[model samples]
Target chain A: EIVAAIETALGGGPLAGRRVLVTSGPTHEPIDPVRYIANRSSGAQGTAIAGALAGLGADVVFVTGPAEVPPPAGVQVVAVETAAQMAEAVRAALPVDAGVFAAAVADWRVASASDRKLKKTRDGIPALEFAENPDILKTVARMTEGRPGLVVGFAAETDDVVAHATAKRARKGCDWIVANDVSPATGIMGGSENAVVLITADGVEDWPRMSKAEVAQRLAARIASALGG
Target chain B: EIVAAIETALGGGPLAGRRVLVTSGPTHEPIDPVRYIANRSSGAQGTAIAGALAGLGADVVFVTGPAEVPPPAGVQVVAVETAAQMAEAVRAALPVDAGVFAAAVADWRVASASDRKLKKTRDGIPALEFAENPDILKTVARMTEGRPGLVVGFAAETDDVVAHATAKRARKGCDWIVANDVSPATGIMGGSENAVVLITADGVEDWPRMSKAEVAQRLAARIASALGG
Candidate 1:
């Protein structure tokens, strides 16, 4: 249903005509004009996924946060900072064949962010009211109309990733959940390699510890298969 | 007082015998193994400052957080993710002639960051308690013992840059405050160019719109002059 033409990378493959939306990086929730709340998501995996999707001949709309890496060439990029902006960007880029929600969207944002920079006090700390950020994947997954044919979400956990991700699949109402253990001991949070579990309606499948690029390629292949390409 | 023979870049000049410390980037205060709070600091200005300091023949100890840009070459880079770690790195790199606090340190960290990832709830959002982060600039500026001869702090403000910066200089007890407006209208925040107001004990000096590199060079020159280089 995406009438607007999206620029895709060179080389037509199995997914040549398909359009995909990919969210990458850590979403910053503004606390003030100069300060924000964010996470340690380097967006390496997300970036790799976007590239993989593009390589598979999909027109990739890369919606990213302030990621460490620059956007990969030959994709339509929409750069947003805060979670709300990211959600809005995601919605705007929707009505695609498939969607990947890989960004570590902050669960909460300051309910009332200060327009001015919050000043430091001698003794007292500022009381920040909190508001839950929109669940982008859930919103897209539950869409009654114009939803992407396949929707994916990610779960970064420290313990019991499968059990947690299994529950998350049901909770978020997403088609699949890519779960990974991000414990410091795993050296996966900011590291280059990742071991993930893919939970679907069928069951959970464990992926071996591999380079993020490999993971992306395998996941992209799976997407192609699921989409009957 | 830096007895350890630290490495210095080639071609000693105005800052040949001086040691300088610079802080940049945004600290990621962990909310969980995978979630954190951070600011929107690109670390461009701080990297430029460190490069400029090194260009002036100063032994630069660059303490940085999770930044978008990579650390500059020929500087002692101490990378950290949290505000506490940044403060510790700064302390360890101390006994310097000058210190530039450019890092956008998160004001608060989760009071008790959960060991495991908080799950997606079906009903309501999780409540996150926050605690004040260590005041890195204030701590370094107020140090009577082994205090850096010249301490400079940055104040990214949106309104009344000079007045707020002047007050911040007095309040934080720092020697000078480099204040800039970050209102979206200015296109300064996360942008390459900056227009700043340098507030000192003498008076406020307005710096023209220039690339962050130029600002760093000028500031480095001022530091060299103050150190009687």
Candidate 2:
């Protein structure tokens, strides 16, 4: 740890003097004071990515939700609960060299979320109205000014992984897309290993299944290369 | 730990030869393959209660959800995710001397839960249809043939704690109700210390704020006395 800090201080690594932003974990959308909607993201991969970036001497800002895994060392950590909170935190951590949007942000939130716990009534079960959450990746990617040089988005699809991710990359106008299949059979949602396909302007590169840390290391190296470090 | 085990084997302590059932944690109601509804229950109090009962030489059957706190040692642990699974698990561990329903089971589950991840579309956000979950506490409490001699329900209320808990006890036909205010200001929802009110046919007993372990020990002693252990 001390050696890494010293190296970072001396600007020794390829990503030295570069600033990067990462959003990790699963954003929780509240239904009431006590209840919320959540996903199966453990933040293992995202945490690993932030650690790898820091190891390469990048000053990292990590905005995360309620994750099972803790934030990595040597990064500015901004902890948030809801998707809206995460979006605000991301906006506050702007103008970085690269932005990695890895968090499993909810698509919609409870529009009629109650401040008080909803009681079971004779009428019937409560109907939960929905409201769309802000598209953080697209907002950052399409920014005309003060935008990160490289905006990498993640696509966790259950079917037609390549097609869905490719479409997502184009729709969001992101520089690259890290796509993965999160079907239960894959055992990758909360698992240590990840099998991902990287989609860029050139084409797709299917990466073999490996530990989340290894994936992070490789991705960090690619980011360094892309930024002409 | 060895001493406790030896004592339990020798049928020692006040609750020797007795069997007790406990349900702990917050039940998750799935919204989709990756998303679900959850609460802020850490299961600290419930785990401590189960441990205390086991320490009193009771054969403890602990049915728990995906809680932050792990189940106590020296108990049969039945892990579950949703309220339906928890209800089934509770039924399977029945015929005990006492039953404690401490889990914050969801009142409703998403009836329109999807097998596949719902994608964002131009149309709008998805509306969630809710269905009432089985009332586990009331079901067991009203069971005529094989109901536990001592049935205890829990009420996590934000307002009118005593009145709400008293009504809950009567409505569920349970012998006792453990009530606590879980308002965000209380800091008791996910905290170690708790201030609770115990409601019974005799009336309400307001307990001073204390560590969850202490509360559990006291409650277990009361259970032992009521069961004639």
Candidate 3:
């Protein structure tokens, strides 16, 4: 019956009944007009997730940074560049059913972004001051009101991946953490397939590597299950 | 002096005194002409990691699945297709200081592959017998001879990501597992960027999402630190 209900919903589900919020891509901390600190994140994952959620009978608000790929179809898309912007967008989209923080948010941003490009005068060395960005996952998890029923964070690591991810779930105060090694050799960052581990308070679940599309489909199914969709 | 000496060895340092073995990409199980069961991994992350390891001065042996991307410069590259082939290659390149299993290995293979393509059926799903493939991480981790000092596995999940990863690491007897949520919308499988959690018996470490390349650099540094390279 539950499955039947979900099928019915997907066939013509009411988005007015459910809302989801997601974040994706790499946040940039500008040092100058020509140079900025950023990682390689296309935001494809986040946008794809938003699309999947919408398909599964939810109203999705996708908050994203600049990405190489386009967002998925059929949803309310909110575009943002910096971590702060992404955070603001997320905060506004709350009181939703769920939240997935898939964005590659920079931990540190320039203390003060330069108004113009910094000139290099062949100095011995130059140092740029940095300040930590707001922890979006922690923020939402700790929200007093308008909080989503579910909050998930992604941990990109290199060593002791599982142990660290489990600890992160606690530290971030989120319900779940998805862990993966980003070692360049894994091609996990900008490539076409991934091997991932899901972490939660209960323990861990390791899935065999699969296509990103497969991951999205399964996750949508699981999220729907959680929402009683 | 340490850095200079290491750089001299490979025109680099850290990895100079280390031997690193890495496995990446997806295994293809051919079912028939132009038809094979395979994951959608491009081997970009894995190869980049090998490059990062090399950059850190480790002598890397990159055992890879068929990838469109070329191996990073300077590392010893061994290319293979099937999981069995990859296993053989890894075993042959053993006696390394550390090992990372980043490949999205196919869990099963066609029991008997057809030499030619089969005709389409009128009204039925095609059935194919399957056999479990050997787990490279488990095999290497349990090896009594020529085993690398550190062994890691990749766990991809959609639901219960961490719980399943923890169990897999324990079962595989690996030193660590990189857990990731490859849920579809996240685009974690391809197009660059990832959010991952590092898991181990000690606990979880949640890292902000980043490029697979950046993750590789950090991981290499960690390995070097651990080995005192």
Candidate 4:
């Protein structure tokens, strides 16, 4: 209560009355009871973004997978494991001022996940069947009602990041797309700093390589100003 | 330094003069510049085992993937990210008294990993082809020269835990197989407590549900006794 009073008295960074939703980490799509498909997302960027939003006094709902880093303080955290669970959590945290889909959600999941541990036999190795996962960003972006005022997505690309992200922005029907070059040579996939191109309706804006926290603060400020804070 | 001296003075449990190798966490196999396939192993049990062995005064080589927890102190930590790299590390840490194959190694990797990030095209979502990963435990257990005296494997099973693990012990040809039920109801996948059955040539030993640390200590003790420490 004292912290809330202080934030209110100091005018609370801007976006004070707004609520935001952010998704981070890689979803684990189960192949069986013990094994699942996952990615190398440490959830550094998404966690930073949630902290930045909360620092700005926004009501933040952070839907995260089994993140390597712990979730930030002062936010509503709903932990999930699989992509399907993450999508459901995102939908449940809807009707916000903005939604940032930064999670590295798996595009496919085992179609027939086994109830038992997969056995290696004399017959041969097990062959897994896969099915496509639901597109969470597109589903929320294409929402006819109860959609967030601003919808943002992330594109982790290796070649021609700007071009690919621009195309992705249109196809996903999201307001903005933050794209990055994740080539191994760049050492950025699980790194601390990031260089991104923010693709908005106005134009593409290139951001210098900076810490994830800086990126989050800049994005939060832009969102506040756009929301007439 | 004081802690090390104290352990050294106490003769460090039963496995004081022995050496052991342990693998932990999930391996990531790349599909593109930014995306990869992974698993949900947290490396908690493996980390505990490493700590326990070190407490027992064993020269421990901890080869781990991108584990959630930091490696235990007073041990050689060889960090890796993919199943192939982990296999290489395990081989390099050979000539030990015991080897614990606890990592949730991915069964497959993308056969033709793209040098560039996979773009979502108008044609459709991309199709990924997988190739089987090498059987690390089996290869070591079947080694002709400089093999560990005792090789322990872990099986995370959903159903028929003891039966499957017994079969696994014969198939892998390892000294012992520690099997656990990782069904969702058990809450053992990412949980702190574990219930495991130790399958050895003598028979199956059912262990009560306990903390990961206790499991590690008990397993380490068993390894020490088997290794004639």
Which prediction has the highest lDDT against the true structure?
Answer: 2
In candidate 1, what are the lDDT values of residues A38-83, reduced to their tens digit?
A: 7768899999999888877888999999787778876899999888
Q: Which candidate, 1 or 3, has the higher DockQ?
A: 1
Docking quality band of candidate 4, CAPRI definitions = medium
The CA lDDT of each predicted structure is: 0.87, 0.92, 0.75, 0.86
Please give the RMSD to the true structure for each candidate, in Å. 5.1, 2.2, 21.4, 3.2
TM-score of 1: 0.88
By DockQ, is 2 or 3 better? 2
What local lDDT score does residue B227 receive in model 2, on the 0 to 100 scale? 89
Q: Candidate 4's error at B90, in angstroms?
A: 1.6
Poorest stretch of ten by lDDT in candidate 1 chain B: B1-10
Against the true structure, what is model 3's DockQ?
A: 0.01
Interface CA RMSD, all predictions? 1.9, 1.1, 23.7, 2.3
How well is each residue in A1-229 modelled by candidate 3, as lDDT tens digits?
3654576466655333688888888776665432444545766666667777777767788888867678888778898877888889987887788898999876667678665434223452234565778889999998887778989898877567898788789988998887877665678767767778988777899978887766776677777777776
Point out the worst 10-residue segment of candidate 4 chain A by lDDT.
A1-10
CAPRI quality level assigned to candidate 3 from its DockQ score: incorrect
Report residue B8 deviation for candidate 4 (angstroms). 3.0
Better of 1 and 3 by TM-score: 1
Tens digits of per-residue lDDT for model 4, A1-229: 3664477458675768789999998888887776677765889899999887888788899999977789999889999988999988987887898998999898878899987777765555677777788999999999999989899999888788899899889999999998988777877777888888999999999999999889988887787777777
lDDT of 1 by residue, B75-159 (tens): 9999998999998999899899999999988888889999877765766667778788898999989998999999999988888
